[model samples]
Target: MAVLKEKKLGAELRSVLEAAFPGQEARYFLPMSIGNAPEHADEGAALILEGRKTLTSSPLWDYLDGTIPFVGALGVLLDGAGQPRGVVETTCVEIMPFRAVTEDMVRAYGEGERTLEWWQSVIGNLYRTSAIRHGATFTEDTPLIWEWFRVVRRL
Candidate 1:
């Protein structure tokens, strides 16, 4: 795999630092977007910034062995256009089966219907689409990377 050795933070991230924490050193991890659609991403980012959304469920297959998110890891959340919007740090991480996700876990996201059924349906659709894109199979027992995060700074 190709790796970038030394690169500066992007313009969006720089602006966020300048606005919220000038001259303070910060290190954020992967670049991630909340949702696939621009409008959906915007809404999710808003909820996150307002402390309304605290949880995210991601497909575990997206990560290789030992590549899963860990507690205290920092990541930059980007908008649909790939512009950084906020920095979030993972406070907890769990690997669980999709069908086994609990209501509490879904409610922790703090958005939409705030119910397990709603979350299952929405996430199921998203994951299903992703599976098709990647030529993979998705099932009720699919493992998921469930992360709980807190906003560090918002742009």
Candidate 2:
């Protein structure tokens, strides 16, 4: 189950965090998508390591209290294989609607085309599918948490 995998990942990440930062405390160990399609986890991790992809987005409802990313929060990037590949420090976070996602955000996403049209098409389909599974509705006004981060270390 995803929960069990996440628990295992948490333990592994705790060890990595201890070895990497020694005394520092990590805010979270984010596994891109638990049970859903990985989407761009591998490419995104690679981009982060290369100092290219610095932005990411998630549905606001996904987090408790609609919490957005914090300025110095550290995250461990997990690959499709559920392996830790790198660490990133959040630099900025913005709350916006899906339709308001910018061209810059699309480019930073580092996915195919890097155009707003392309981004919309892809995200729309994804959101629609998710909404169907949850018995919800998808719309352009769907709230999203946009985060910009920088890779601090590669594992």
The TM-score leader among the candidates is 2
Error of 2 at 20 (Å): 2.0
Worst 10 residues of 1 by lDDT: 1-10
lDDT of each: 0.70, 0.66
Tens-place lDDT digits, model 2, residues 8-102 = 23767777766776666746544342235454556655666787667777765455454456877666777767778877778888888889988
Which pairs of residues collide in model 2? none
Off by over 4 Å in 2: 1-9, 33-35, 38-40, 64-68
Model 1's lDDT to the true fold?
Answer: 0.70
Where does candidate 1 stray beyond 4 Å?
1-27, 64-66
RMSD of 2: 4.0
lDDT (Cα, tens digit) per residue for candidate 1, span 1-110: 00011124576665665565555444444556666567777777777888888888777556644466678766677665667788887899888878987888777777
